[model samples]
Target: MLSDTGYPGAVGSDTYDLIDRQLVHALQLAPRAAFSRLAAVLGVSDQTVARRYGRLRGAGAVRVLGLTDPERLGEARWQLRVRCAPDSAGAVAAALARREDTVWVSLNSGGTEISCTTRTPPERADHSLLLQHLPRTPSVLSVAAHCVLHTFFGGAQSLVAKSGALSAEQVAALAPDGPETAGSDSPVPELDATDRRLLGVLAVDGRAPLAELAAACGKSESTVRRRLEELTSSGALYFDLDVDWRIFGLRSHTCLWLNVVPSELAAAGEALAAHPEVAYACATTGPSNLHAVVITRGARELYTYLTTRVAALSGVQHVETAPTIRTVKGPGPLPLPSPRDI
Candidate 1:
């Protein structure tokens, strides 16, 4: 089900027969969109949507994840591009996929190359380790990684149209079954400039203190608190975990880009995500169709992990690796109004 790198996918592989292309389609529209609402648009029952969504999450086909704004949040993110010996490259790619902090990995262009991503405290990890740690391995030939100053979703959901086209059942699915809803209307939160700024701050720094943020933004402590509450209540914000892979002792880092058979796409994706090293895997619209990020303690440990672990997975035809250089931001921030206007 896999092919050599740079082998044009147009040549046809069984990878396109995906199970829940709908899930990916939904995510591209609203990453955190409620499953109930999605059921309506997809013409499926609410519970079915929920169950399938759970399956998609389990399979790694649809990542309904959120990104924190790194800029205002006082953190940085980065990417690593690894070039390893062609023969040992798949082993290296598998090795890097195991880390918790690896955002994604991919083998692209050909088997000689790979790429890995991570989010970390800005400028903290030894840049040399980020670059040198993996390539130093016996199987590795060369490596390159760059700390990302900024990262943004390429808007994959827009690939699917009709965002608000939920079915009637789907609309009811969004309703909370509470006595208050019997007679009273559920409150919908409103956002203003301060609300937006407060969200922007948290988007970048989840740990930013309310008092400090208020002071920095020139608003009252209570006002900031209320704004935060309102925005979160409105579902305008979501939380996620962020860690530095190295400090977390997940030292071996690499990106894996895999080409799977069309018939095997769903199974291959599910298998990859189920692996502990396959921290984040996604079927994007691209070359190394399947991408993942993995982490390990060091080179020796990573080598064993790849060959003995990842190389054994079925439907995995080819793999490549790119050792990371460094991470400037993890998942930190999104755009905010100028002058820190909240």
Candidate 2:
């Protein structure tokens, strides 16, 4: 266990249990909802909810982050699978994670493979800087880049929400009001400098207060609110709930590459997305068109899921599994320097 003065440890003993799982689901439903409101929804006292939230946050088990929609910004998102020498895999993966361009990074294939996602502006999508650097590194054995074509489910959704703790009605009640239709008519709306600044702050902490956002963006509270609403309406910005999977006894983290019949691709992707173990699923352009991430309690649970849930899907021709040994970087905002530093 980490001392109180130090950073939260990976998994505190017994910090996660049935009630903790329920609370995580509640937060997943409403990432920035008020404690009292969440308390009412979960049928617990406000203090209980607050205390649990504090514990989870202090343990570094859960985090709420705001992310910009790359598609909305006309940026191309790429998934890179890189194989490296066993001894140098950690160095390679860490190097990729340290770049501001990469967001999600995982070390898989018994620590010999690294997988990550990065975005490139429209004009430079063909030649991302990270892509250029990897090939020149002697440690990298091979690399395959897949352009994400479509997401059946998973940017804003959380794996914790799939635990079935809350009913549909409860989730609907807790969900924040979505933006009204306004700027979505255009497929791509350009973001100005102030919009970028606003997004930079939001990315770090989605629940930042209006006053702080106003001060950072040099705008009035009302203006900041209106801009935020407009950004959401246009699909330019959204929030994601992230968690340390270890806390939930889900130690097995694996990525699946699936080749499904063309006609049944959508059906297959949707079915996988609905599984409680799945955290991410998307269609991409590569040898395997569909990619998914699953976390489970252990190898046995993973086997059950693959044999029963996954194998049951029709039209799945082949599946490849790469179990992640360590997470170089999990999902969230890019590791950019803080706004103050900038």
Candidate 3:
């Protein structure tokens, strides 16, 4: 049965039950697992698992999506901070949310700044959003682009995995076969037209049925399944969940910019990645060499985290916190605007 709690906006008052959390964690381990398989691991009826997921998805509490890894494709990933006029931040964020390349579009710094991540292919470097579009926008006051150097966590790694709702045995049982990436010496795999079509379908729904994927990709079920495995094993594709953290009693979301000693940069990033509060952490080229997105229960928890956990780290000189005012986009693609809206 569904909970009696209301579907709160981004930060809500109600929390999901243990079963719900366990189910989410299970999915994080095996996103494309069959309903029967998930039920077996979760010790719940298949119908119950499906119903709970449906309810959560209907309430906009969770979403499952398939995403490409920019590194595997030899593309450039950027973290952008766009400072806009006070009155223009909302419009600027909405415009950015409409972009296919932009993800995690957020209004931060009291809604006067927009933070987002964008992926650029090699061919589009000359005409990318950072180099061309944002600079020409009249309402944009300034733009800071940080080239992502290395990700310590948060591509296929999900916070739910750290929730401890699932047992170690269950996690091992659901772990997918094959490594996520090839060695550096291995040649990068290219995505053909068929692979692109398959990925397009999965970008919307990672758990789409085999028959549905086969039809959409104009291939047989066997072929589609094989290709899916190939992409995942090659580290060219991954499944991610966009979950409303409020459902877990986490109400505060903030981005942290930190400058660490060059010698300890890698250690600092790895340490941040292990923190359950950190949703994403990476090393980037900028004045602030380390970047992380953290979520906490509320203002008090965020303060405590900064004072204790973050302050305890070594070689950390400074920290800048940009509280997210609103999030307009997540991990998935958004519907493109029509000519009239544009």
lDDT (Cα) of model 2: 0.78
Order candidates by lDDT, high to low. Answer: 3, 2, 1
Model 3 per-residue lDDT tens digits across residues 138-237? 8999999999999998888887787788899998889867665665556656888888888998887888899999998899999998888778777889
Q: Per-residue CA lDDT of candidate 2, range 163-228, in tens?
A: 777778777788767643235355545788888888888877777788989998999999998888
lDDT of 3 at 182: 63
State, as a TM-score between 0 and 1, how close model 2 is to the true structure: 0.89
For lDDT, the strongest prediction is 3
Q: Give candidates' CA RMSD values in order.
A: 16.7, 4.0, 4.0
Stretches of model 1 off by over 4 angstroms after superposition: 1-192, 214-235, 333-342
Q: Model 1 misses residue 82 by how many Å? A: 12
Candidate 1 lDDT tens digits, 50-157: 776555433322233334333333444455666777787667765665543454455644567666565555456554446566757777767655544322221111
- TM-score-wise, the better of 1 and 3 is 3
Regions of candidate 2 where Cα sits further than 4 Å from its true position: 1-8, 178-189, 334-342
Worst 10 residues of 1 by lDDT: 1-10
